[model samples]
Target: MSNDNAAPSSSSAAANGSADSAAPRRNSKRPKYSKFTQQELPACKPILTPGWVISAFLLVSVIFVPIGVASLFASRDVVEVVDRYETACIPAQNRTNKVAYIQSSANKICVRTLTVPKRMKAPIYIYYELDNFYQNHRRYVKSRNDMQLRSNSSQDDTSNCKPEDLINGTAIVPCGLIAWSLFNDTYSFSRGNESLNVNKKDISWKSDRDHKFGDNVFPKNFQSGGLKGGGSLNESKPRAGGSHCVDENCSSTNFQKVVWEDRGGSQQR
Candidate 1:
């Protein structure tokens, strides 16, 4: 009886092993269906209707109306004096050929008398404005190397400012149309022959002078190209404070100019 049972058990084991081996295996690399892949999961989606759109507009108005009114009220105390001197500053004889006038080394200064209705309080600001110049154009926008500005080590990394990027393979610091065409205008504030002390110290953005631009970085081959733009930079000094005041496009009071650098695009004002 024991012999018969052992033989039957061995035969059953062999049959089971043979059956398992003979079954076809599933491919491990095969993709399987998933609810996520098929996008069958439930979600909350907002539909925009006429009522919903109107509600959104009302909500924005409710939140921003007070802020706008408050801003106007606050700025009312501040006084701004703007002088568009591009045309007035230029010598009448050279108005037609402003490009040549700017390129020349001749003195570019004009005194324009300004009448301020309200007295400019302390911390009087000065500004210059531009018209008909597209500083945001694609070519002008991409013609800068921020890496070079941020770090002294990356001065050679001027791949963006092509054409103005280099001079005989030497990279330009602050290379770009923005930097080349820097706002080189100089202003002297005076009220009836009394020179007001224009406090220029710490006027620029603290974050930019300290962080955005590297302290070790200075100008190199700037305005050295065939066609020079607005300004020239000091070679020995670092760019921290040596650079021209260009944090903004256009500010201060009723003032007269002693000297103004004629710098801008062909169509600039």
Candidate 2:
């Protein structure tokens, strides 16, 4: 029984070894990912910096601000400088010297001009002063003096001052026409007030020679010397026409001379 058992065990071991050797060796396969080409990111582009923009703006301001300021100041100075010859120039140009001093204060502007002379006095035409409402607070003053007149004429005697160009016996040389035009233009620019009609040519002056051009207006309560018209100086009780303060003889008063008034609240030129 032992021999039988031993023989069978040896035969089983031999069979198992044969079975193990007969089986084929198999290798395991691994899972694989898809094959694709990788894409590269694009390089960043250069952008404008905030600091550069700010620096450019600052540079422009530095260059232009001073020039703008200088130009403004230069124009102001030029206007003030030209205001010195109000009275002297009018008489020198054979034109009458006109003065307009408004009453009281409201809407008041002191206007004066240098009248351009007649044909005999050509080339000596002095443009009347054309000041309007103040542009700035900077005042300009010119005092009364004969020296400011620019004329080589020995007939410098301003005794019987001629009225501004007016309707002569036959000729209609409008009085204060040029001066009125200038005053209107300048006043409009300075004040921008449309109602202040300083340049209206339609309005008539009651008196030509005796009538003064102050504001180119007649005082409401004022009476005119009757000469022809009822409320006119020409038809006053007696003929009060000729010129301001001149007697019926039309004698030369020598007071007809124009003198510059105060400027900047002080006398100058």
Best by lDDT: 1
* Model 2 misplaced stretches (Cα beyond 4 Å): 1-49, 65-169, 174-176, 179-269
Root mean square deviation (Cα) for candidate 1: 11.9
Error of 2 at 151 (Å): 22
Q: Score every model by TM-score.
A: 0.61, 0.18
Which pairs clash in model 1?
Answer: 125-252, 126-251, 126-252, 127-251
Candidate RMSDs in Å, in order, are: 11.9, 29.5
Candidate lDDT scores, in order, read 0.67, 0.31
Off by over 4 Å in 1: 1-76, 241-269
lDDT of 2 by residue, 85-191 (tens): 44543444333424421111234333544232322322211223434544233221111112212221311222222232222222111112111111221222122
lDDT of 1 by residue, 80-136 (tens): 766777888888898999988888989877788888878767655565666776776
